[model samples]
Target: MNARREGDAAVQSYRRAQQRLRDGGKDVSSEQRLIRIEDALDALLDGLVKQREQIGSGVAVDVAGHTLAARARSRR
Candidate 1:
């Protein structure tokens, strides 16, 4: 999937998980629940990392192109 899709899916899943936990009240303190929360958090982080990587790559490319153009103009 694309970066935005992946990011949106991650956010939705995290929100669902959080809601489930909130609804669980005092009965969802099992190890499984903790594991689920941890997994959700990890997925959220992974999505954020992917989005940031895509953004950073684009910014870097733009900056490099601008620098090259500036140098070429100076040489002319």
Candidate 2:
């Protein structure tokens, strides 16, 4: 799958994990799932942050080439 598809899947996974935890998913398995998802999503956030920093430093580093930051320049 493409980056966008993977991002959407990550979001869905996060929501499901959050809901499960909020719904009293306190068992060991549920916590394990939550931790795994969080770790993955945290890495996703790190990548996005790095991209933002690159853009700020006058570097065009939008790997997928369709991010909001990539389009921000054209809309001006």
Candidate 3:
């Protein structure tokens, strides 16, 4: 799917997650909320990555990999 469509889906997913935490009788705690946010963000990232791949845009992935390798080498 296109980036806009993927983004829309991610937004919908985020709303659903928020609703789950806010629904009546829900027992989600602050820590769980944070985890949910992280999970949502990861899902959004994955969607974005897929969109980039579909569009044949590899610059972002290449740049991320280069930065990651540089950071890893610096730590070694």
- Please, what are the lDDT tens digits per residue for candidate 3 over residues 1-76? 3445655665666566566445444477777877767776666566566555544435555677899999999999
Model 3: residues >4 Å from true position, as ranges?
1-26, 57-76
Ten contiguous residues with the weakest lDDT in model 3: 50-59
Q: What are the models' TM-scores?
A: 0.54, 0.37, 0.42
Deviation in angstroms for 51 in model 2?
A: 0.4
lDDT of 1 by residue, 10-49 (tens): 5666676566555555666688678777776775666567
> Candidate 1: minimum summed lDDT over ten consecutive residues — where?
1-10
Model 1 collision count: 0
Give the runs in model 1 whose Cα sits over 4 Å from its true position.
Answer: 1-29
Candidate 1 pairs with clashing backbones: none
Candidate 2 residues 6-70, lDDT tens each? 45555665565555445534465866877766766675665565444545444333443557756
Off-target runs (Cα >4 Å) in candidate 2 are 1-28, 59-76
Error of 2 at 23 (Å): 24
The whole-model C-alpha lDDT of candidate 1 against the native structure comes to 0.67
